[model samples]
Target: MKENVQQILAHFHIKQFQHDLIHWFQTEQRDLPWRKDKDPYKIWVSEVMLQQTRVDTVIPYFYHFIEKFPTLDSLAEAEEEEVLKAWEGLGYYSRIRHLHEAVKEVKEKYGGCVPASKEQFSSLKGVGPYTTGAVLSIAYGIPEPAVDGNVMRVLSRIFYITDDIAKGSTRKKFENIVSHIISHDNPSDFNQALMELGALVCTPKNPSCFLCPVQRHCRAFAEGVETELPVKTKGKAPKRVSFRAIVLMNEKGNILIQKRPPRGLLANLWQFPNDEHAPTRNDESFVKEISERYHVVIRSMERIGSFEHVFSHVVWHIEAYKGNALELQMGDETNKWVTIDELKQYAFPVIYQKIWQAYE
Candidate 1:
């Protein structure tokens, strides 16, 4: 494998390639908020948020998050619920949960400083290789490679790599290649450049190869198979799951919302009461289910409407029902009755937020 890697490396002018890529990045990099400073905490938050989310979508959230939790100590001192609330509408609640847990760990174990070493950062709750490398290199100017999907796409097309990116082994292979070609002097810019190139020019479908800085050295471009080189097997389609979501209102104009369990998808976030089974048209059974689950009885239920939410691996086909409860339940820790104004304070999943907006 070492000999094979060497053979692959022999094909390119590594130093020149790195110089060109870094130069391109310096001139063309986007003016993202996170790029303003090399703070480890800021870099860490941005990297985590960027996972499975787009740059444009993350900008405002990033600004808001930084304003709220300006420092690692501030993030560590924040309550888990508050952190989740700050991360509201950014799907993938687990990221913020893990980030909060990791921040607390850093505060407790590392004296409120984000650890610079690989071993220390890796030990944090959700600090994986990609995040560790990104923060260390970008924040500390350490010579490490942050090989994310964008980097993978850029490298794969350049070298005409045919490995399945969805596989773990392939990722390690890409990481090794990244280490081999990474600019020791400017690892942060070099790594970010590769990602930027992939994002803006060397795109997946319609790569702007003509504008690509490293197009002169791109193997797939020479071979006329740029788009076809990075072979990836498709994952299974998202499973469709249907549910009946109940929006229970009381005479006081308060609505009933429930907190999800501590563990699982959308964990600990607040949402309207929803069940997997379809409720009866009259919603007697639905009211009964809500009553049984939360220990609260509803007088009647009116079918509101239906909405669909799609996650990476699941699609929620939700039928919404609105009704008035006999008594607003507050005894159950997970259940609450709050006015719409008060509801704004709690963190709700985006799907429920949409429902609330439409209902309003």
Candidate 2:
């Protein structure tokens, strides 16, 4: 069986594959903002933003982010709140938080130059295997393989590897294969080519083998099983949690918002007063919870609408309401009153943004 695996691996002519792949990439790679220059900082930022996010969605954010913090020094100097605000609409708040923290460390420890060495770079916060390989190979022409899910799928089909991609062991196998075959002539374009191929042609379903640059080299395509090679198991469904988000407006029309805990999901971001509750909880219960929790007597409560925000682990079913803040019976450091016009200055979660856009 091991000998048979070796035969299959040898069938994939690495040199020809590299030439076809990289040539296709040089011709067809998308004109992305991060691809314009090989600035490691920008590449790092783009990678973070691109995590589970669509390329189209990340484009404008990348432009805005680069404009706001053009250099690692500027990003390192930024306050956490300002960074969070800049990354407001981009979900996965923790990505930016970790990147911000890591950038500060890079500034202090590495003099704001992103470390090219794998050991030093991976030691930084949130720098994982994929990130380390990507930065090093792309920035420094290292021949290390950046085997992300996309690369895994592309490889699985090309080599007819039947391992389940959902398994970590399978990922390790693909990474090993990539390490052996990745281009020494141009590692940057080779890695990007694998990713681009996965994105454009070798998609999750209905792979476009006809348009594939390396179609003649694909083992799965030869057997007419290209779509069936990269097997993956489904993960557990997210838990559903209910929340009642109360927009408490003072007589002057100033809305009250609070800061999320500094350590959990949506950490350090601002939001309208909201807390998890049982779905069976009524409007009176919501008002009571807010009044008791914030020490405010809410009057004229009117339910606007319901919206759902799906996180990886949990789905938030939010019920939004508008009410008058009759009196401030107590005060908390985390809560603040800002005018509706001033709300734009604060960075709320995307669910709140959706609610406000609809409500406004």
Candidate 3:
């Protein structure tokens, strides 16, 4: 490890760089609420919530979450529906579900405390390598490296490593390097400083190289190629999809909303009844199909609007229609009519939320 650190420092002149980075971090690290506590539970929650989520966006959610379920037991006790409702509008519902399950496992299996060992904790629900290292080192002062996207970018650029970042071997290489370089005495600070440097100075686009503490030591800076480091293979393009969303409303102003099937895209979420094919000029046929499908009678049909939404893996072209319900029967077990006030009770996926807002 000493040899590795020495080589990195000698190659990139990192001693002064690390020193200055630590100094800047002391005074300039964002005053986030999560930074105030070293508790592994709190840190773990914050880390999970922050994954693929921006810092500013996670702030309020974190505070609200901690306030709601401060202790591991509380989170463990929460119902999945209740938890998902609390996590409404947060795109990745799976994270919250995993988090809830993990807390329950921790409470029942490991007492109330989050496990301290990296290997043990990593095997827990939703506890991946990055998260395990982050919790162990930041909360328990273990000499482990938490290599997230920010850390990866910083390392790749500073060290000028040209490996494909998406590959598993590249990640392991970074992890091994970080394991060797992180200071054992003050593991938390060292780990955080690297992350902070990446977030603040080694940003994805137009990094602030001039303000960086380790600018002189960065290989990308010397070579004028900071933007190009951490190369990754391209993934398949997002799939495109189309759906016809039926906004059925009665004279009473109650709108029909149905819960998605228990699994697959937007699982268990509330949405307007919809189909794949768009209606031609005579949308009456579309309404008739809905009536036949749900065993309901459609008294009238009116076109509201058309809109589209994009998700991580698919794009939705939704054709929305307003119809008057003549009869009510459930073809799908999860269908229901909900008032505007009642709509707030259940969690709708973000895409549906956008359409709901537009309807309002």
Candidate 4:
């Protein structure tokens, strides 16, 4: 078995593969700005921003962020609020926080330079095996394989591996194979080519095998099982949460946006204070609870349209209600009332932004 694997590896001609991939990439790869420089900071930022985000979706954000904080020193010196504001539409707020903290740590410890070694890079917050591998390969020319979803799918199809690719063990298996073949010379282009091949030609569904540079070496294509490899595990249903948002507005067009507790969902982000599980219809108990909590005289309540916002693992059924505040009082220190013009001053979750836009 070892000899057979060795024979297969030798036949693939890793250098030729890398050379062909780089040639294809130079001609066909998308013209992204991050690809223009080998700066570790830019590469690190692009890798972090691209997590759970599509390349097209991240382009504008990346350009804007790069323009705002061009260097590692600038990013390290910037305020957390500014960072979060820059990352507003990008979900997974924790990534932004981790990146912000990592910038500070890298600046203080590594003299504002992103670490080049995999071991040292992985020590930073939010830097996992994949991120470390990506940064090391792309920024420092280390022979590390950055196996992500696209790479996994592409590799599975090429090797005709039908095992459930969703398992962590399956990922490790693929990484082992990749680590063996990844070339030390220009591993960055090889890693990027693998990703681009997957994204452009070897797509999950309806892959354009004719356009693939590696089709001749693909075992799955030879076996006519290209679509069947890389079996996926079934996804669990997302948890559903229901909440009522008390949209308090005064005659002055100022809206009441409360800051949630420093932890939990939308932590420290602004939102309209309301009951956790709002009743299906109007209930006196729910109304009373809101009145007591805010300590404000409720003049009248009018129901606004409900909207559903779905996250990766959670779903929120949000019902908006316009409340008339009689006695002007900020109930909680964590909460505050801001004018419509001040909306841009704070970092708000995208779901709330949708509501605010609709309100406006």
Give lDDT tens digits, candidate 4, residues 213-326: 888778899999998867999889999988777677766656777776665676667677678744445646657877777666677787777889998889988887777776
Cα lDDT tens digits, model 3, 62-170, are 8898998888889889877777887787667678877888888899889989989777789887888888888898899998889888888998898887778878667
* Candidate 3, pairs of clashing residues: none
Give lDDT for model 1. Answer: 0.85
| Stretches of model 3 off by over 4 angstroms after superposition | 1-18, 250-253, 276-285, 330-333
| Top candidate by TM-score | 1
Better of 1 and 4 by TM-score: 1
Using TM-score as the measure, what is the rank order of every candidate, best first?
Answer: 1, 2, 4, 3
Model 4 spans > 4 angstroms off: 1-11, 251-253, 277-283, 327-333
Residue 136 alpha-carbon offset, candidate 3, angstroms: 1.6
Clashes found in each candidate (C-alpha, N, C closer than 3 A): 0, 0, 0, 0
lDDT at 1, model 2: 16
**Candidates sorted on lDDT, descending:** 2, 1, 4, 3
lDDT of 2 by residue, 55-75 (tens): 999999999999999999999
lDDT of 1 by residue, 91-149 (tens): 88889999999999999999988888899998888788898888898998888889899
Cα RMSD of all models vs. native, in order, equals 1.8, 1.9, 3.2, 2.4
- In terms of lDDT, model 2 sits at 0.86
Best by lDDT: 2
